[model samples]
Target: MPNTNGILGRKLGMTRVYNEFGQASPVTVIEAGPCVVLQKKTVGKEGYNAVQVGFREKKPSRLNKPEVGHFKKSGGTGYYHVREFKVEDPKIYELGQQVNVTEVIKIGDKVDVTGRAKGRGFQGVIKRHGFSGGRATHGSDFQRQPGSIGSSAYPSRVIKGKKMPGHMGTDKQTVKNLIVIDIRVEENILLVKGAVPGAKNGLVSIYIKKA
Candidate 1:
C-alpha cells in the first residue's frame, strides 16, 4: 500500500549513480521537505479533510501583513510555497508541525510527483506536435506551415482543437509510480528512479498514493 502523507520540495537536478556491479542508474534529485503544517481542515468545521503545508523560508519583507499574520498563527518563520493535501484523517496532524520526507517515504516506495513543466515558448506544429513538414525538394513553399486545418463546405473556419502550433509547455504535469531510489534524511533529499516534470529548482509536490 502507498503512504497517505506527502511533502513539498524543489527539484534539484538529475544525476547518475552506479551500483555494485557497475550498472549506472539515472535519478532525479529532489530537495524534499522539512515542510511545516500550516493549517488543518476538519470535516465537522471545514466540511472536508486536508492539511495545508508550507515550504521554503521567505523574508518577512517579501510578504505582506496578511501573509505574515497567517504564518505567525501557525508558529512558522515564513514560507514562499504553500499547498494543500487532502487526507483521510486530518485530526492526526496539527499546526506548526514539521513534516519530513522520511515520514511519508522510504526506500523502494513508489510516488507521484506533480510540478510545472518547462516552457518551450511559441513553436510550430513540427516542433510542438511532431508534424512532418512539406517535402523540401518540392516547389511547394509550405515547409513549416500547418497545411489545411478545416474543410471547405462542411465547416468554413478552422475547427477547434486542431493540431495547430502556438505556445507549449509550462503546464502542470504528474509523473506516477516513480520508484524511490534513495533518501538522505539529514539533507532532505530524495532520489527517484525516473524523471519528474519542471525545471531545476522548481517547486514540486511528492505524494504516495495507493497504486
Candidate 2:
C-alpha cells in the first residue's frame, strides 16, 4: 500500500535555525503526528480509498455517548482531533494503528500546511485588501474609509465580489510547497521553513507534496 503522506499536528511556535554556515532561516515549529488509525474506507464500500485518523487523545468524560461509542471500536481511546487522508488503498492500515510523522515525511521534502489564519474582526479595505489610504496631511477626511463603493450610472449597485472588506482572517488557508527544515523524531516535532497559517497552538494539517 502507498503511504498516506499526511498527518495532523499543532503549531507550537516559530523560531530560527542555522545551517552549517551559520546562516539563519526562520522556521515554524509543529508538534506532529503519532496519530492512530480510527477507520478506513475502500472504494468498493465507501466509494473511495481513505484512512481516518485521530490525534491528541481526549478524556472519555468530555465526549458524548456517540463519540465514546465510536472511539470504542478503536481501542476505547478518545481523540481531540480526527481527520481523513486519501490513500491509494485502505487495506494496509488496521484500526488503532499508530502513524508517526517520520514514517511518511522526511527532511527537505515539500509539504502543504493547512490551518485557519488568525482572525482580525471587521476591518476596512485599507487593512484587509492593502488599499493605500488618503494622504496623511491635514484635513484629509477620506482617511481609512473605503471610498465610493459603486457608481450611480449603469450598474447602479455594488458589484459582486468587490474588494470592500467586512471581515478579515479566520479563514481556512493552505501554504503550499514549504520545505521541511528539520524533524525531531524523539519529540515528534517538525520544523518547516517560512511562516504558516494560524496563531500559536492552532491545529494544522500537513501533507507531503505529491510528485
Candidate 3:
C-alpha cells in the first residue's frame, strides 16, 4: 500500500499443501506484515525514496530512551524488528500507517525470502563443506580430518577462502524465486512453495521479485 515491494515477517515452519490435482507440495509458512511505517525518506530530502517499517510490536518498557524517542513520532509504539524498503514514492505512505501482507504480494507471485540460516556451531569439513572422508577400513586414521590444507614449500600458508572446518551456518541467506502458493489475509499468513532458510520462528524479509 506504500509503494513498497517487500515486507518483514517470521518463519512459521513448513507444511504440505494439496492442489486441485491432489498433488502435495511442500511449502514454508510465513507470518507476514501488519508492519507499521516508522519513517519516510523522500528523494528531495534523503536523496532516495524509501520507507522504514517496523514489525512485531514490543513493550515500551523494553525499549531504551533513544528507541522510545525514535518511535515517539510513530504513535509511540515500539517494535522488535525495523527494516527499510525502497519505494517509488515515499510521500504516499504516512507515518504510523500499517501495511498488510496482501498490499505488497499476492498468490502466484514470485518472491525472494531472506533469513539467517540455522547455526551448526563449530562443524567439521565433512558436515560443513560436504567433503568425503577418507577410507574407514584398514586402520585409516584420516576419517574425517581435512587432509592437506596447503603445500609446505609453495604457498607456505593456508589459502584464504579455503573451505575448512569452522563455524557453520547462522549467516544471512536468500532463497530466490520462491512461488507464493497461498495467502490468508485475515491471518496474515503466506504459504510459499519450497523450503526457505533459517529455523522456525526466525525473522525473514520477503521481497517480491522485480523481474
Candidate 4:
C-alpha cells in the first residue's frame, strides 16, 4: 500500500549507485527531514484540515520576535522553512510532533513533487516559447526576434499576454507521478525514478499522487 504521509527532503547532490544486477543508476541523494509539526489545522478552526510542517531550524538570533513567538508556542527553535500540507486525518498528527522520511515512505510508491524551475534569464522566442527563427543562409534579420508583435495597424497595439521574449523560468513547477524506487531509512533518503525539478539544493515538496 502507498504511504499517505509526504516527506520534505533536500537534494544532497547526485551520484551513480549500482542496482541489484550491478548496473549503474543515476540517483539524486536527498536528505528528507525530521520535520517538526508547527501547527495542526482543523476543519472548524481553519475551515480545512492540514498540518504545518517545518524543516531546517534557524538560529534564535536569526529569527524575529514574531517568528520567535510562533515557534515558542509549538516548543521549537526557529524553523526556517514551513509549509502546510493537507491531510484528511488529523488523528495521526499532533502539534510539535516530529516527522521524518522513514515514517511515510516505502520502497515503491508514486509521488508528485513541486519546486522552482531553473532560471534562464531573458530568453528569446526561439528558446523560450519554441518559435522557429529566420533562415540561417539568407539575410535573417528577424533571426531571434519575436517578429511583428502586434497586428499591423489593424490592432495597432501589442496584444496582452504575448509570448514575447522576456524573463524565463524560476517559476513554480510540479512534476507528477514519479515512482519511488528505493528508500534509506537510516540516512533519511529517497531514490526516485527520473529527475526531480529545480537545481541542486533547491526546496522541493513531495506529496502523495492521486490514483
For TM-score, the strongest prediction is 3
What is the lDDT, from 0 to 100, of the residue 45 in candidate 3?
92
Candidate 4 residue-wise lDDT, 1-211, digit = tens: 2223576778766777777899977766677787888888789888988888898889999999889888986785878788888888765776778887777766677888887889999888999999987767666676666777888767789989999888999999988887777888877788877677788988888887664
Model 4 whole-model lDDT (C-alpha atoms):
0.79
lDDT of 1 by residue, 1-211 (tens): 2223688999999999888999999999999988888988889999988889999989887988889888997884789999998889887877888888898888999999999999999999999999999988758888899998999998788888999989999999999999999999889999999899999999999988664
- Clashes within 3 Å, all models in order: 0, 0, 0, 0
- Candidate 4 regions exceeding 4 Å error are 1-4, 22-24
What is candidate 3's lDDT per residue for 1-211, written digit by digit as tens?
Answer: 4458899999999999999999999999999989999999888999998999999999988999999999998899999999999999887988999999999998899999999999999999999999999999999998999999888898899889999989999999999999999999889999999999999999999998986
Model 4 TM-score relative to the real fold: 0.90
Query: What are the runs in model 3 whose C-alpha is more than 4 Å off?
Result: none
Cα error, residue 45 of model 4, in Å, equals 1.5
TM-score per candidate, chains pooled = 0.94, 0.95, 0.96, 0.90
lDDT of each: 0.89, 0.93, 0.94, 0.79
- lDDT tens digits, residue span 1-211, model 2: 4578799999999999999999999999999989999999999998999999999999888999999888998899999999999999788898999999999899999999999999999998988999998887787787787888897996899999999979899999999999999999999999999999999999999999998
- Please name the candidate that would achieve the greatest lDDT relative to the true structure: 3
Relative to the unseen true structure, what is the C-alpha lDDT of residue 24 in candidate 4, on a scale of 0 to 100? 78
